[model samples]
Target chain A: MCDSCGCDLASNNHSHDTDSRIIEVHQSLLAANDAMAARNKAHFEAMGAVAINMISSPGSGKTTLLEKTIERLKKKIRIGVIEGDIETDRDAQRIRAKGVPVIQLTTGGACHLDAAQVHKGIHLLEKEPGGARLDLLFIENVGNLVCPATFDLGEHQRVVLVSVPEGPDKPAKYPKAFISSQIFLITKTDLLPYFDFPVTEARREALHLNPRLQVMALSATSGEGFEAWISYLEGLTGKTRKDNFPPLLSQS
Target chain B: MHEMSLVQALLTQLTSLAAEHDKKKVITVTLTIGPLSGVVIDSFQFGFDILSAESNLTKGARLIITSPTVSYHCVRCGSIQTAAMRPDHCPECSETLLIAEGGDAIILNQVEME
Candidate 1:
């Protein structure tokens, strides 16, 4: 009998046979991606920038929120964006029109943007006019809630968004997205009056999944509850509103 | 499906392992897919069944998958409970806030090659 695998063999010298053997190996399938993500994190830190990955479903207002955020903070802080999409550079174009460095990564068909894709985006972005220096870098993930949650893009913060029209059951249905995120944004608050979405229920469901998640509701259109969002970004970048005080009264 | 991509990754790993061991064929591959890994078990199986047939080394290889339970820690009572599915509340304190830990890994455990 073969002692290694308990296989019935007439020859006791099967050890040297080398025809069959059981190899004990334990490793995560995502090890390669994780190693790349670690390198990307180091790269982001070396560039003196903080990276944030945004995950949400289609039409959840990720780009609109980013546009508003850039319009609000671009003057105070240097901002860059890496947009991921299945096709078309439309998102990248929109970000570029805001007078900031931006790169678009089209997965071609992949549902999620992996670390390798973001690594390429970072290199291309650095070559842009203002991309070399940035206070904040936002990687807008391919509009997906499921597969995107499994890939780590080396972002300092992971934010998941759900618009009012998407209903309040998103957090409950997409537990993985909520579980892995640091912040949960309820976007499109202006539509709350028209939709059946309940903000409190969504917040509670997300909090139940991840207690450490910082929940906020905002509308990029009406600017409702936008202060908190701005403050959060300012807090991360260690920048404050410079326009708050008049230039004559500002401290040199 | 993303499962197809994962299956390709597995096949690549298996090919390298076979080459390292000087083995020509893989007999069995054992893996652990956690419940919270966000991978559909059936989709993964379907992907493996299709992709493995395209490779000589992994063709007709048996895939054994084991799903492990996740541990949910209660915020109120500090009690911990382990279950394959997410518990609605803490077993001891009935606390609704339970933080899940672990059970999000997809690991290749072992392989039998010939």
Candidate 2:
């Protein structure tokens, strides 16, 4: 039924009920997720956490990088994690083993973690030990590169990782991840000798698509070119590391 | 798929809109899907066709989708170019770096319900 429009010319008083009227609704379909993401950002900022959302293909060494980063920054920065996976709490368990608060978010059959799920994860994380206070909070998104890039999880920065073995064609194929990400991390550089991955081409293509992307390469296993990564992390929190290590960013 | 979730959100919004307008049935729905929105148009239409049929309020509703052109601001020449697809280079200055503006939207524009 439509709102009654007075038109005495119409003999039938109920004519409006049969007419289909168009209603203007200029609203984004992601309004719900974005609103929740804003709230999640506020929550993270209130807790003094620099949140980073990590996106990459499975086996891109996301958890490995995190494990190493936790070991390196735990003493200097109060770190926490929120691990997202399609199933199982395996990644969360690994992060928790490092003696820091970590929350596991299983998306069941869903391909990506939405803002509503991350909102719940944030509240659940605060219930864990030392979760309420942190300098950096890492939200390890689902391993799929495509779907995760479409959703925002209320992180301050978005980091997209592509391992050396995954090849450098990733940027060209999955442009959304590279275009949407702030920092692009090239992982598993230790295997560069064995793999024919042209690291420079990868960085070039990503930069061509997104000129502002900060690209860095490192191997979490060998710690080669890892200091820059750590310094980048420290710079995010802006001189908040408790270790008070001299800033290594001037050289980076 | 994220498309399914998005279709679900659309359906929910449609239901609320119908209730708000005191309408019994939805006739048509219009939406805008941007090229860089990361949403596959086919998957979204498939999801809408399947999910909307399950709800009485939106059953048999016709879905119309339009893709709006995006303006890519050339980083070199500072010229803005609008296109349905992301261009490889700036047409004016021949620069490869162009920051895309708009065209990342997935919005519900209009609906007819009675």
Candidate 3:
């Protein structure tokens, strides 16, 4: 037997048949998506925008959080949104009502938004009024925890959110989402009294999955524990509380 | 499942490989799916079984899949352990916060054609 190619034919007497051969091609299946994601990252940087990808299950208050965030930061920062959904432009419509440049990407039944879809969404968003230049871009991924965590959309940061009603076991049940995300936001905290969710246990589980995860719990409705989230956004945009308002006393 | 999408990608890759090498049929395709790749092996195989039948080039193609073990490093003791699933705690230090490394790739290793 031929030892080189592990063929049944003898090495010295085997015919040089190109018909049969083994090709060694070691490459990642997600390489194409990753390359496009890199290009999307460069495009975002070129526009001087910090893009964030938000992942969560449906009804996790992702849209509500964004609405409140835009209300708070629109005066100081230019915000845009790319909303992904399996069907329906409702989320985009809601974001548009906030007076920001927002585009809706209907995935056509796909569970997750890949980098290519986000690239198209970026171009469409740029065509909208006040979209050409922005300080931040929020890509609201299709509301599914398992699939979105597998695809990179060229975002600067990834945030995985779970609502108090969704329970604290999300991190344990969906390990990939928690493991890949940099931030874990527990939304709808005002329902704590009505729900049995334990914030500490949720944070601890998420931290166990990813030690570097920044976990924060907030209620957009009650405005509870929201200051930290706003400050974190300001930090990402390289702005401070003073930047949004005049200094109390001038240094000069 | 996204495994169907990945299977479609694999079929595309196989079609191109056949054209590039002037082969008539694909005999075997080998893949290495890591424990943390977020891909279900059974789903991927089911996808392959259904999709590969649509084309003559990849029909009856044998798929060989191997999953690599993930390595977890103890945060307290710095000891490393490899397992197919996440270990409950560090064997050396009883620490529960072990950091995982690698084992998150879906790689197309090799293809045999005739």
Q: What is the TM-score of each candidate against the true structure?
A: 0.93, 0.92, 0.92
In model 2, residue pairs whose N, Cα or C atoms come closer than 3 Å (at least 3 residues apart or on different chains), thus clashing, are none
lDDT of 1 by residue, A8-84 (tens): 88665655555889888898888778889999999999888999999999999999899888887887799999999
Worst 10 residues of 1 chain A by lDDT: A243-252
DockQ of 1: 0.86
How far in Å is the alpha carbon of A114 misplaced in model 1? 0.1
Q: Whose TM-score is greatest here?
A: 1
Q: Evaluate candidate 1 by giving its C-alpha RMSD to the native, one decimal.
A: 4.0
Expressed as tens digits, the lDDT of each residue in A133-198 for candidate 2 is 999999999998898998888999999999999999999888888889999999999999999899
Model 2 global lDDT (CA atoms, 0 to 1): 0.90
lDDT of 2 at A175: 81
lDDT of 3 by residue, A70-122 (tens): 88888889999999999999999999998999999999988899999999999
Query: For residues B1-114, what per-residue lDDT tens digits would candidate 2 score against the true structure?
Result: 789999998998998988899988999999999988889999999999999999888889999999989998999889999987778899888999888888889999999888
- Candidates' DockQ values? 0.86, 0.80, 0.78
Rank candidates by TM-score, best first.
1, 3, 2
- After superposing the true interface residues, what Cα RMSD does each candidate give? 0.9, 1.0, 1.0
Query: Candidate 1 vs candidate 2: which has greater TM-score?
Result: 1
- Candidate 3's residue-wise lDDT over B1-114, tens digit each? 888878987898889989998998999999999878889999999999999999999999999999999999888999999998888889998998988898989999999999
Q: Which candidate would rank higher by TM-score, 2 or 3?
A: 3
